[model samples]
Each structure stands twice: as C-alpha cells, then as structure tokens.
Target: MARTVTPEIVAHVKRFEGCKLFAYPDPGSVNGEPWTIGYGHTSDSFLKVRKGMTITQAQADAALEHDLNEVADAVERLVKVHLTDNQFGALVSFAFNVGNKAFANSSLLKKLNAGNYDAVPAELARWNKNDGKVMKGLTNRRAAEAGLWAKGSFVASNTVEAAPGNPIKDLTKPETITAAGGLLSGAAALATGSPAIQIAVGICLVVAVGVIAFLVIRKATR
Candidate 1:
C-alpha cells in the first residue's frame, strides 16, 4: 500500500498549484483541452470541471484529497524502492502534477526502480516543460519536488528549505462550514486509513454531497 504524505507536503502541493473558485483552462494544456478548477484539478479528477463552472472551497478541498490519494496509490504501485515520508510526499506531488501515466512512463521511474535514487532529482528536473515549452511554474514546482526528494535522502541538507509556500491551512475556521473540516481532515483521514478499500469508496462518500451541491449550484446559475 502507498504511504500518505504529511500535511506539509499537501500544503506544498496546494501552494504551487494554487486554487481558483471558478473553472479555467490549464496553462500547461495546449488549446485548453481539459478545463480545471479548485487547485488545478481537471476532468481527470473525481469532480469534473467545465467552462463557466464554479466550486465552493469545501468541494474543491474534497476533490484535491481524492486526487492526491490516487496519486499516492500510484506511487505505491510503481516504485519498488523504500522511501521516507518526505521522499514519498515529493513523488506524490510530482506525480500529481505530471499525471500518473506520464510519471509511470518517465525515465525517472525507471531510474528510481533501478535503485539509482540519487539520480532522481536530476531526472525530475528534465520534466520542467509543457507543450514543448519550458514553464517557469513547472520549473519551480520541479525544484520544490527535488528539494523534497533530497530532504528525505542521506543527502538531506540545510539548504533544503521545507518546501516554499504558505503554511498548512486550517480550513475549518469559523468562517467555513463544519462539514468542510475535511479540507485538511480529508487528506489526513484518507492518508491514514487502516484498510485499503477506504482509499476509494470511503473518500467518495465523504465528498459526495459536495459534488451534488456543486451540480445544484451550477444548474441554478444556468
């Protein structure tokens, strides 16, 4: 089974990915093929985003956990070597951004599986492009992922600032709904689930209402 990433990693990913309440195009995606919403989430996620659609923060948070959990599961399936919490988190973040298929087919995966752990950071750096162009955002995200990867290795050093970003967000403040505690709560919950089945079915039920509400809101707006 895949290990869950710490809240810090979740925050690291959310910070770079950033969130928008409304649906928008993937800057990295050519022709804006897949619409995205609520923290760079796309049709590839559990909750599909479309043009003119908007999502509440609660729903967006749920979608993020669902997506991240899937990525963690993928990391578990593909990588044969052992990893520390930080190493695991770093890979999860990378896979989350690049897509499981891309990560699976990547030379980085091949190198890591070959036990060339030290080569991974450099391998990760090669992926700092999108649509045949190098993106500053992708470059920064890759650097962060590399830093995270290094931090968990024997090469861990002081220069590795604990991923650059805002501190972990407490989404359950009085300003938000109580049910929405799953913002961070959901990720932690799924990350620590005792049984393997919880990774899928349990997570969906937790956020099912949010999905329904989003549809209701979209219809009312139309």
Candidate 2:
C-alpha cells in the first residue's frame, strides 16, 4: 500500500509560506485579527457563509489531522492516477484553501482528470494571483504546485500505460525571441556619452571642490 502524507506537514508548509490558515493571530503576529483557516491558509474567512472561529494551536492542529482524510480523498478522485506523496499533499493543500468545489472546477484539476498533463503548468500559473494581479505569495504557491505536478506520474487505473508529459523536459529548451527593439526617444540625456560623460565627470569634480573649500574655510575660520 502507498504511504499517506499527513496534513500536519502540509499545514506547516502553508504556514511557513506566510498564508493565513485561520483568523487567529497572524502566523507570528501573536496579536493580529483572525484571518485564515483550514488545512490551507485560506484568507477569505470573513465571508459569513462558512464562518470560522478563532482557534488555539491545539485546535488548529487537531483540525488539520481531521481534514487530511477529506483532502486526500478529493485528490484521489481529481487526479488521473496515483500521485506522489508530495503531489498529493500539494493539491490537498490547494483544495484545503480553495475548497473542494473550486478544485473540482479548476482548470488545473480538469486538465489532470482528463489526463491532459501537459497543460498542468498553465493551470498552475493561473493560480499565480489573487485580485487579478501577481503577488509573491501566489507565485510561491504556484511554484510549489508546479513541482508537485511534475513529480506525479499517471498510469491507467487497471492497465500499465504511462500518461504523457514531462514538465522538466518541456522546460529545457530556451525560449525563442521573435521580436526586439531599442530605447525610447529623448532618453539620451540620461545616457553617458563621451561629451556627456565628461560633463558629468566635471560636475562631480566641481561638487567635490566646493565641499573641500567649505571644509577648509570652516577650519580657517575656527
């Protein structure tokens, strides 16, 4: 039997990445308002639809352990085949934060479930933002998910066929640049030229001379 990855580890990873799990004090805030929840660091805790309670570490830890089974089951059905422990944990963490229905409808999960593994990274990249803009937090989360997606291998449920796609191999080729251009007009003054460079150099020398003269005058006056 395959070994199960625990939710405790997933929770720890999410927290370490600075996601808010519950409305409790920020990970280390110790005094901030209750903010995130679930096996994930879900930030939308104030929606009032599924209201959450402020929890102690003991409570949060227990909830994590309990939620692992639910998350793992969801991953099993969502994936085309068996996933590595890391892959399982990563998706489970995603589901924990985003909710099972969101996972169900996700382009990432749909691609995986359809065995269209090649498209997983694009789906992963789609999650690279909240509020329609890129952020460091989402970028890191997408990176983690992409790593997991690459690690997972698909095979027929009963047969022995390899599902295609290798993200690492796909990434090895350098990107092609089809178009290129130059600097904007009127930007040349900011640039250094033989004459411009000498002028800039002279300006620095004059500034230095002024500073030295002021210091010497101050000394003499003293």
Candidate 3:
C-alpha cells in the first residue's frame, strides 16, 4: 500500500518553509531567480508562480496541499522499504525542502534502503549547510525530521542503536539548557562573593530567562 503524508508532517513543513502570499525570489538565488510563492512552491509548480504574482492565504494553503501530495507520491515511489507514517512524513518534508531529485540521490535514502536506519539522522543533518554555510534553521529542521523518522519502529526501534557521538544525544533541548543555565548562574553568584559581580550576573540571568520565555511563547503561538 502507498503511504500518505500526514497533516502533522504538512504542518511541520509549513512551519519551516513559512507562507508568503506574494511571490518572492529565492533568498539564496541571484537576479532572474525562479520565483517562489505559497509555502516554498516554485515556478516549476503548475500554479503559475511568477515575479510580482500575488496569492490569497487560502490559495497558498491549497497550493501547499497540492505540492505536498505530489512530493508524497514521489517519496512513495522511490522508497522501496515499508515505512511508518512518521518516516514517510519525514522523507516528504526532506524532499519538500531539498527537492525530490536530491532526496532520491541522497546517502540518507541509500542507508535507509540498506537497512542502516541508525545512520539516517546524521545523513539528514549533513544537508543543513547551503551555499557552503551551515544554517541553524536547517540543522534544527533536520533534527526534528530525524526525531520523526524514528518515532515508530519495527526496524528502527529494534535494529538501530545509538552509535558513539550520535547527534541526537548531543542535541540539547532548550528546556534543559534553560535549567542548566539557571543552575550555573546561581553557582557563579555564590562562588564570586562579590556584590557587584553577583548583581551583574543576576541581571544577566534575568534578561536571559525573560528572552527564553518570550521565545517559548512566540513558538507556542506560531
């Protein structure tokens, strides 16, 4: 049976790609670049994206649905192994971001086909760089994809083991970082025993905590 892309996967792609109602040039492209509209829908789409073109949010959403369906179909055709919804969704998101050709040719796909599922996350993270620079957003997106890819398992759960230096283990969740920072700040304040230094550290910690809270709220609302 052909697998389908889930709504959760669609939302993940949308959150990362972001919706632009009006057509815009690819950020990394030079002049005369192919225009992208909707949720990263490009000129290659049948929807007729062009310079100066505009679309309603409803139109964008419709375009995204169409695009994801095509990508999902491509993923289904290319992947030979049976996949869970989460794995299929992760691959679709990857193909949506990197293009079907890249996804088809990727070492990630190769490893997946070879039943080396444990190596998939590292392979996904390798694509986090663009134009020879590492992008933090892509890194985060790939990590999320890896997490989803491993969500369910007949194969991944049973066969895959965390290798030494696994990136997943190294990924520090934001909440953990916040908690650790608080502890470190408290320790520093106590160790210094200098009133001025303690006051400065306290102010910095307050600002850091406030910023973290704001970011969390913003992400939640989004």
Best by lDDT: 3
Per-residue lDDT of 63-153 in model 3, one digit per residue for the tens? 8988999999999998888788898899899999999999988888888888886787899989999889999999999999999988876
Of candidate 2, the 10-residue stretch with the lowest lDDT total is 176-185
Native-to-model Cα distance after best TM-score fit, residue 8 in candidate 2, in Å: 8.0
lDDT of 1 by residue, 103-130 (tens): 9999999999999888898988998887
lDDT of 2 by residue, 119-216 (tens): 76677777766667787877877777667656645436556664555444333323311110112122244345687775775576567546654554
Query: Please, what is the whole-model Cα lDDT of each candidate in the order they appear?
Result: 0.80, 0.57, 0.82
Q: Rank the models by TM-score, top first.
A: 3, 1, 2
TM-score of model 1 (CA atoms): 0.65
Error of 3 at 163 (Å): 22
Which regions in candidate 3 have their CA more than 4 angstroms from the true location?
154-222
Q: What's the CA error at residue 210 for candidate 3, in Å?
A: 50
Q: After superposition, how far is residue 55 of candidate 1 from its true place, in Å?
A: 1.0
Least accurate 10 contiguous residues by lDDT in model 3 = 162-171
Model 2 / residue 98 / CA error / Å: 2.0
Q: Global CA lDDT of candidate 3, please?
A: 0.82
- Candidate 2 global CA lDDT score: 0.57
